[model samples]
Target chain A: MTVNATILSKPQVKNAGKLLAVLAAAALLFAAFLLANGADPLAIYSNMISSTLFTPYGIGEVLIKSTPLILIAVGTCISAKAGLVNVGGEGQFAIGALFSTAAGLSIGDSLPSFMGIVVMMLAGVFGGAIWSGVAGILKIRANMNETLTTLIMNYIAYQIVSYFVFNDLKDPDSFNWPQTAKIAHSLRLPRIAGKINLGILIALAAAVIVWLLVRKTKWGYSLRIVGGNANAALHAGINVEMVQIVAMLLSGALAGLAGAIEIAGVEERLRQTTGVNYGYLGFLAAWMAWNDPAVAVLTAAVIGFLSVSGNVLEISSGLPSSAISILMAIVLFAILWKGKGRKSE
Target chain B: MILESLLAGAVQSGTSVLLTVCGETVSERAGVINLGTEGCMAVGALFAYIVCAETGQPFLAIPVACIAGGLMGLLHAYFVISRKANQLATGLTLMFLGLGLTAFLGRNYVSVSTEGFTKLRIPFLADIPIIGDALFDQDPITYLSYLICAGMCLLLYKTRFGLILRATGEDENVVYAYGADPIRMRYLSVIMGGMLSALGGAQLSIAYTHTWIEGMTGSRGVIGVALVCIAAWNPAKAFIGAYIFGAAQALQMILQQQGLEISSFLLMMIPYVLVLIALFAASIKKNGKMPAELKKVFEAV
Candidate 1:
């Protein structure tokens, strides 16, 4: 007699179950870490929620931090959808900031405020696109690994900015601080609320645009095809290389836009350490969202909230801000682990 | 005289990279790739530094650092091998995890000094000529690196276990058919890679710089990763590649010493730029030799 013992469940349901389990595991792990560090997990978590969500200023800070993260995370989504990994977001962001700063410094006084802002944004986009395009072209033409190339490019970008800021762009009136001259007042982004600028709106709009493009456009269809199976896409007569390169350009442009927004909206002047962890944090956000652009927006907000809450934890519990990194790592490990397990089963 | 000094410096700087490359080469040979070398090195460096600082035992630090790194490797292996997660992403995540954990725990250890390894000149070899001083007169870790590199070469090329490891990387199914557990082999190699990377980190903190600093490994761990590819996954060639990068690093300092008027920032870009160029060169050949499993890492997305 033949026995049939297969269990029946919807794929989506199974996936949801797995995700919940992973998240619970991560929470437990984090609680253990908290206890080991001599802090009350319940109290610390409550403080994080109240400080980051209930307070008006805290909400504004969340929006401010989430702006760049949403932009970069969406950029990462685009690249991931094209079967490419663009770790160059860090470098691209730096280049974008550099170009925007340079443009603002050179021509901010000569143009109308709106025109100056547009010019700076355009310059920033072009700079980031060019920086990412280098790696994209190398990958397509030379078969070089984009992951390593993009990471190395980040260091190179930092050096370029450092060279200029230390020598040519030094703010003369700042008493030898390593920073560029402030952008003209007219060129700075207008604040919409307390510590909140129009960049958040731009980020939200970009997310919608990206979602629509990925869900509706023919280009998005081709990108998904390539990411799913390059060989099959090639057999289907899709120009795989072109799709990859264009996706990289678009991905890099978004990150560049984030850089521009951060500089114009927040810093107002280029500093050596601007947009420090946004690239990697955005990467984590995209990964958390499973490369879904729409989900990425929510994920970025959550990450940004946690980031700001890290400061609260630092002050209230005497925990270092870097502790948040361990939380992120645990979440990442759980997701990856669960995702792989479900796929194999 | 300048050339001799440059060569000597090249060897010194290359020691850490050499150790890391050898470690990565072994892991890749056994059908696993651990991109967490940087993270492992960072954590290892911190552990070694703290141990040395607290106990004043420089020798004990190396083993402690290895254990720390091995534990990290075991974690990575559990995810990549047992859980079957994507190796590249997991490696990157581990990198951030290491960076964050070390930064958090190492806050107090920064700027701390300890008893460190000193230069030991081989009596007969030290008097040979320009090459002698450059090669024979070095710290204990440097000599250990030389021994490790040679040992890896022999281990990879001359042993029955080595053949199985190579076969596992080339095709795990074949190894499984032969009744060898590919998963076990992968775990072993990856853990060893972590330990070796940690050893390199210990060398950096205890033998080279002698002081613990945050993110002190800088990008050398990443550089070591790239060197594996540039060397085509061969341990001997990895040794050569490390020294080549070392020479590039040494050249920059030499130029600065000669008052070349270049920005230090630009000089710092040399090794990274060379990595890009080397990657390009390595990729130029479509049929380039690499462990078959490693190639899948790039192509599999």
Candidate 2:
């Protein structure tokens, strides 16, 4: 290989050991947790893999789970590049679903399918931005902390949606379960047979949009400058506050879109079951990718795979769904912990 | 008598969570964010409940629970202090890890009824009207919370020890130039925080509920973090923050009990909404009231 190609490929080679180490440590954690919990670790793990990928149905499950993760992780990576921590992705996702579900049900076939989809997506983006922009403005105007504000916003978002879902949005047909009425397919994301659908296309288009914005745009350049050195960017005549605000708004919009797509394409309703909290799982994905959007695509997919398989482990071992959460935490901690080992030198 | 009972509920939530708030207060005073306090409390609650149930003794449960909480704090120290990971993220992961581990270990202890300790209502004080019912009638831990808050105040403001801890937090590099170890100081503070956090959990299981549930601490841990802002780092004022928040929660249940004209859920949302306000205020403060020592401890995001 040419020296440049080899160098370009070295990040992959360099990354593999870290990934392996994390995976191995994670495996060890699972083994210990399972052995203590009285489940056969190997059997559960192998079963998880088979159940997640062994069939055509399994592929759809993986894609279904992977979709939200991709969107949220991408948003996280984008914001992280600008040095803004949008831990509110989940809230933004929830708000998107919240705004659209109310609107989607009301407008379920009052318009053309394409027009309805467009409206839903716009509502999702608007909902997400409005949710996140509060934190952004707090950061810009009040010097408020975004992380905690967004976190508190998450609780508020939860309460808001719960109010609607439990009270107003309750599907009259579902016996009091806190979920919305399903929309007509005309409002649903178009399908691509076997449950795979056009949401993936939206995700891909988002990735491309983010990549182009970051690599080829002046705003991306300024964001990097600001992220690296806020004082320096301020000195360089960049409107730091405006950049931070706009960045957060876009960041929230994209995440909101993920919630909208996930609801319209996969879940079809806002259930209290947290068919939506993969945003917590997505935090690790963005971190593992070091907040680089392109790499987050892969990170999101990997997490998606682990969780999908984790479901299988749940079935065979009678373990809780939270077993996967524990595993994700282990992996995330290891990544940060191991990364720290490097910095310690 | 009915008012007396409701007052006890307010005191129970307030005083019990005070351990967590105090523990976090001590941590934040050192400029280390112990967002993991919730997870620590959960773990502490699990251990406290399990031990109390198994041993049928309250005193023994407290120690076991505190020790469990301290160990988790030590893990936090390992990452946040030793390795210098992002305090917010590290603290958050600590919460996630604590939640999972506590739930995993708490499998056998769920909904298992156990005898809990009795209240130590003060004599003449308990018989007095409104204020008396609110303050004087509570468990021994409730009184201890007052002592702990006062003790923390004394520790933070009175002695040379407090100065070192404060200086260690305010400008550790400066503290370091003066030949003190900021790391050692922060580690000590974190452990203190861990122990108190455990006691906080002990109060939850051994003092009030007397049983453990999965994720039972709910948002109390996060609220403890917010209480720091509410308390503005004053131990005594923290009690006000804690009691007021606890009362906010108690009011929700009380309004429901009285069949008041508000949505029960809306009442429940009150403290959380207040937390959002507290967070906004913390962010926008003219940057002075925030302990100067924290800047010395955690430099940037």
Specify the highest-lDDT model's number: 1
Deviation (Å) of B260 in candidate 2: 2.7
Top candidate on TM-score is 1
TM for candidate 2 is 0.93
Q: How would you encode candidate 2's per-residue C-alpha lDDT over B61-151 as one tens digit per residue? A: 8778878988988988888877766776677788888888888778778878888677777999887877786787777767877888889
State the lDDT at B44 in candidate 2: 85
Error of 2 at B112 (Å): 0.9
For every candidate in turn, the CA RMSD to the true structure comes to 3.8, 2.7
What is the alpha-carbon RMSD of candidate 1 to the true structure?
3.8
Candidate 2 runs further than 4 Å off = A1-15, A340-345, B1-8, B281-288, B291-301
lDDT of 2 at A118: 86
Score chain A of model 1 by TM-score against the reference chain A: 0.90
